[model samples]
Target: MRSFCLLAFVVALLLPTQSFAANRDQHIIVVSVDGLAAYLLNDPKAPLPTIRKLAKAGSVAEGGMKVSNPSVTWPNHSSVITGVRPEKHGVLANGVLVRGAIDVPTVVDPKRDQQDLIRVKTIIDAAHEVGLATAEINWPCMRGSKSLDDSFPDVPEQVIHMTPRLRQELVIDGILADETQPSFAANSVVGKDLIWTEAACHLIRQRKPNLLFVHLLNCDATHHLLGAQTPAGYTANAYADSCVAKMVAATKEAGIFDKTTFIILADHGFTSTPKAICPNVLLRQNELLTVTAGKMSDAKIHVFPEGGIGLVYCTNPATAAADREKFRDLMKDKEGVAEVIFPDRFTELGIPHPREYNQSPDAVLVAKDGYAVAGTPIGEEFVVANTESKTALGSHGFISSLDKMNAPLVLSGNGVRTGETLKSVENIDVAPTIAKLLGIEFPSADGKALNAALSK
Candidate 1:
């Protein structure tokens, strides 16, 4: 009897693992259209035929997806893949916020790799662990991720940062001049988007990774240059739609369109702000900050602007309490100051405490509608009119609870509920939903799988 039991155990061990191989045939592609607000879908003037078709053919989040606090590109994108907010994922900005010495100004450095920015395991990591192929194109905070089988990261020198295989392939296909090619610069934003689209399509056709992520940036750039809901924004949306169509075509050409699922969504929405609120000027006037030689030399406090919000950092811990109170008093009756969020409310707002994460701010300043935050410390006036050459006409990075920051969501293709409209969803739920569709285990995710949108 002992010999028979030993033989059975050996047989079981020799067989393939059922759990990891269950959904080997499934493919999931997540595409993020930058600056695609939920309201744009209902706008009569917004040109989005491809996106509209996807909505009609599959499940739609009518109320849109609520993003994490500090609704910027990198943090929300991290939440989309990790199924957690900034408090858990630890990405406070578009990159790593380096807390320098008390005498130096805190800086947001974007040159860091994935391991430096993200604290939690991503969906790509889970998939790769189970022997599934994964790829990311123009995805931020993924500069040097070994989990991805193929990667074309979004950084300063994109062409140089691509994985060795991807760079070689692009060069062989005549898409790029060489491995040392400096930039992907094009005549217009639309032209630059086309290059990224072409690279993504090529990746899909050749690699056919089980999991893929693609980010398009034309709409976001256009919205910043011209206000949202304007004619220029509409044109940019139309260009993004065409890029989506090309990706869909690539899937079809690869013969995986029937077996593939596409999650088309945006990181956050845009808001128009005609005026700029310079909270750093207030700190400068109170002698909390000092500038010398055209640069900040000695600073007791600093305000880092993130579009519609400003992150207040106190350089000295001993004076943090007193400094917060003093700044609150300074901006008591300011024109564009909306609310001063102190450290006590950080937990409720899904932000980490400064003691826990270096990127966490001592306080957060919210801007009122029609106003955006600026980091100019030496401006004579605290609030100034936004000019086309100086400031962005449209911005995001506001509190996620604001209705104007709601992002659009659409799920289509295999394993999706057809023609269903969801009232609302959160961006953190995306990773778990993808895991469920792929028959993978993502037990550490904070958000639950969106079972309502899945057909099983």
Candidate 2:
């Protein structure tokens, strides 16, 4: 009787040990560099020691990947986590119409704890179903998210929309939730927030979540404030690199470094521009805009008389081919206009042209690299002149330029092939690959599984 009882105890211990090891294999950590470029690792001029080490330690892609349209922060980051496009994910833009007013919310909504905003299942959600723990820091589309067992959340700062100092403190107010807070870059030296590394370390040591996601937004803020090439932008990137290194070291110290897999990715890259163009000015100048509306926020540019949606706002679908030619000629003639794509061409570019539901805009005008669309209000036939904002040195949102599409994706750690370069892949592929890695499923995702980068 004593021998049988001892045997049973030994079996119970062995069974749980095997199960815990298997769960460790299934866990992963995803980190976002915000605007990390694949070249950053290869660039001798830039010193990203930690990233270089991670690349050396595991598999790394030569170039990054991105989603279809509005290749901005919210859309791309959401895709990274959920593996769904903006069209499918329902996070069409950074801001969505909360009420009748165009009161769109940024990724950092004050009401993120609600959890109903998410339309798709994230990698974490899939993990949680199998009894895995999840955590996130500054990941977008996280409001009303149920995927996390613990999350720092991609919330906006209180006080001002961009001012996150107060909000950061508030997030860490509770015991279980107060593991770590993000280290934000400060305008002044006196008010410096700790780096992301410190916060990530705290989470690892305190909560020790299974799947962790983090975003470092200093690069995006730098790009918005200064052009990519400026001294300030360069400095900001270096600072971000330092923060990344700290997080990597912390993971190592936690003794989970070798057991963990790290995926370092970015939302989009940056480019410098000399000027910004607003095609709405031309439409208003030509009296091409017809106003029977109070205000037009979802603006599109139409080509001519209107065969299909040429641009977003100028919706003259019945326009003749000759007029379409004229609009194309006008867009081409513009100095800053990069390329003018007709509806058919737009569809080929992966964007469904706005039709009855504004699917087909008349003609889509791509701004030259380094230029962006001016956020001008539309009323009757009118052009809101663009005030030169410090020469518009750094900007994105162009299809013709590679900067808009190119982003970095680094896969490392367990179950990832070390030093492998996937020459070609898309942003949509990330979700499916993560699903397979964790033994989850997302049948609705259009992205195919990148099985080559994974290990058996």
Candidate 3:
């Protein structure tokens, strides 16, 4: 009996420990520069000193590719953190789909899911599971993330909350003092650059989370307001890059510089399209879209009325099949329309196409590189006036060259190989690499560990 008891105790001691562990003392900071291109790092013309330095010292993906459809902020951002596609994570677009279960339309309510509601283990969650702390500063869809040690949900104030006059009064009170600087008052967490810098710096100085995620949208906002190649867009890009430099400095000042691994990435690239194609106008010509007072608030347009698998959804499902056929035939008739995809083709490209929900648009249309589609009807051929407007400067949401696929993944510091490059990799691979760095289990992750690039 004594021998058996001793043997049992020895076996128990030899068993593997049941918790994830931080593989290194160095921290991992994931930064997203909205609409940033991979070339930004190597572009000497762009004055991004800190980013260029990191690129030179770290391993970088040739260019970061993104997921398809809605291809907007929330889904792609969620994909990098969660290691899943939009379909799997359920963030279809910047806007949420409303099936009329509630009295009001449901936007992407960040508060719906509690922390543990995330089924897939995020890099942060994996870090935490293995006993490493985490933090996020202004990353999208993070309003309800319970795993974060510190977070500020991107809540905007409405006219109902405070009038312009009242807003000034509140600003004087410093009730809305910027988190970074604590001196200025700004409307959104983003514009208060000094505040975010201060807040992130403070977190790094004090708590020192194992994984930190920061997203700065000022650049993308600038691009949306200015064209991609325009001076305004370039200036915004420079400003965003400077903010990144500040972050790198902060980590170093905190004395975690050597141990921390920093990664700079972008969600998607921007494009310049100056025309809007109104498919609804064509539907009107066919008597499919009935306009009341020349306003269309409730009616849906069969954007790709002729595609085999559809992209858009309308209240009237009965007309979809015939309408899809019509839209496809019309595009076929048009000279410049590049590609028209039905719902079926989206899946073939490895893009998620949900069959159970009406999340996708009607038939999808792809215009040439210089062309853009508008919500309103103009003519068979039309140009968006004021194409030079700030809002007309740059845009995205199309299928084209890798220039739109441009983004970067630069990893540096402890546990990561210095001065390396990941030849060709997918965005899905980020989660697993972080998991390996933190020594956590991400069993369901589709990406590899990228062990070849990092220290074992």
Which RMSD values do the candidates have, in order?
A: 2.1, 7.7, 5.9
Tens-digit lDDT string for candidate 1 (259-365): 99999999999999888988877777788899787556778888888888999888887888898788788878899888999988998778898888888988898
Considering lDDT, which of the candidate structures 1 and 3 is the better prediction for this target? 1
Between prediction 1 and prediction 3, the one with superior TM-score is: 1
> Model 3 Cα RMSD, Å?
5.9
What's each prediction's TM-score?
0.95, 0.73, 0.81
Model 2 is weakest, by summed lDDT over 10 consecutive residues, at 99-108
Global lDDT of each model? 0.87, 0.57, 0.60
**Cα lDDT of model 3 by residue, 1-456, tens digit:** 999999999987875453524565758888888777666566556667777778677676765554434455666777788777655665655545443221111223333342422335577766666567887766766655657777643323221222233234334545345223224333453555444555566667767878888777777777666665567767877887788877788887888888888878887777665554555566556665555665543443434321111234444466656656666775675533677777777654445554544555444676556555554433344334425211244566555243664566777667777666786566667888888777777766766766756875
**Model 1 misses residue 250 by how many Å?**
0.8
Question: Which tens-of-lDDT digit does each residue in 1-456 have in candidate 2?
Answer: 999999999988765332343354555677787765544555575666766777787776665665445566666776776676655554434534132212111122234432444457666676676666677766776754656665555655311222243245444642223323333322232122233445566676665667888788766666656655557766666776677676677777777776677777877776655544555456545654433353333322332111011134343345434455666776766666566776666545554444522323345666655455553334322222233522234554445137444777778777788768786677778877776676656566778877778885
Q: Candidate 2: what lDDT?
A: 0.57
Model 3 scores a TM of: 0.81
Worst 10-residue lDDT window, candidate 3:
99-108
Which ranges in model 2 have alpha carbons more than 4 Å from their true place?
A: 1-25, 97-118, 157-197, 287-311, 314-332, 342-346, 352-363, 377-392, 400-404
User: Which rank order by TM-score, best down to worst?
Assistant: 1, 3, 2
